[model samples]
Target: MTDRRVQKTKKAIREAYLSLILEKETPKITITEIAQRADIDRKTFYLHYDSIEDIIHEFGRQETEALILHLEQNDFFDDTADMAALFRALNALIEANLELYQHIARTPSYAFLWGQIKDILKVSLTETMGERLDIPRAQLEICAEFYASGTISTYLAWLRGDLPMSDDQLAEIVGDIAYYGLHKLISPPKAEGDEG
Candidate 1:
């Protein structure tokens, strides 16, 4: 009975947090507002979180985890895949919690949220590139950092209105770059011996 009550109380708190965010910017909302919305007192709120920021982090963490799982559910890790769907996964995340993220991105906890994103991408990339990439330790770390930053930065660009492209289009474009690599940037000199 105690466990069930705790679960119910936590659920109420989470749902109330979402409610408040959807209703207004996260800043305008306060612990009092959330506690009231949860139909609980300030004591209960404190029992669950050290601060409002802690609850906010919990919310973003849940969102990032859900995005990762949804990607796995759709078999986004299929062998020979280009990992384009990962971008789509990100898009789905933004769309799923559009209001919340829009607000959180403006908060001081934005860096923590980004850290979660990087961790998720690191796990997924390692799974996808396993064995196929016998990269050196240095190169492996560099590859993960480059592609993870590229993905996040590209998504941020889309969010900030750099491109009018939809999530799918953005995903395809980014995926192509990942799959084709920077080789296309080089020019080939035509030679007599090069003719097949």
Candidate 2:
């Protein structure tokens, strides 16, 4: 286990970096700025991280691990997983980290972070769903990638105000799409003589 003081220092660094990212693009952020904001000297900052990108990468790694752990604890990979409940749990996790997610969503430079997270989820989903489903591994992987990418992209859109829906509503819609596909959401064409 890491020492408490080390953990504290790392937390400070991460918080400082996140705050800086919110103000400007990642490339414009400097180690000096992070050290100053974190109230630590340059040497101390180097002790904890190599650069701003390191902090960002660490944040992505930590959040991805947290997501996987959360899903596992919630039985998200179980054979009888409850799609609705799983999505609700996912939304709750996202809500809990709304600021971080919002930062990632609005910052174009952080797009790769989101992509990395989504790819990890796709792999996990592909492995588990493959074992459960009788379909070929390649097809299952494609399907998992589709669902994982679509769900995360939709959540990002919601975060950016493009969806303008509540967490519960988003979760419900995502769950529906996962279980029933787009056909469930689309209405059949109206007859020519149909009236409102």
Clashes of each: 0, 0
Q: Which residue pairs show collisions in model 2?
A: none
Per-residue CA lDDT of model 1 for 1-196, tens digit only, reads: 9999988988899889877776776678799999999999999999988887787678768877888787877778775365677777787878976666655555454667777887788667766775478878677667777788787777766765677987788888887677667564455778877865
Quick one: best lDDT, which candidate?
2
Off by over 4 Å in 2: 187-196
lDDT of 2 by residue, 56-104 (tens): 8998888788777877787777743556665676677678778778778
lDDT of 1 at 7: 84
Could you tell me the TM-score of candidate 2? 0.88
Residue-level error in angstroms, candidate 2, position 81: 3.9
| Cand. 2 Cα-lDDT | 0.82
- Model 2 lowest lDDT segment of ten: 79-88
Candidate 2 lDDT at 100 equals: 74
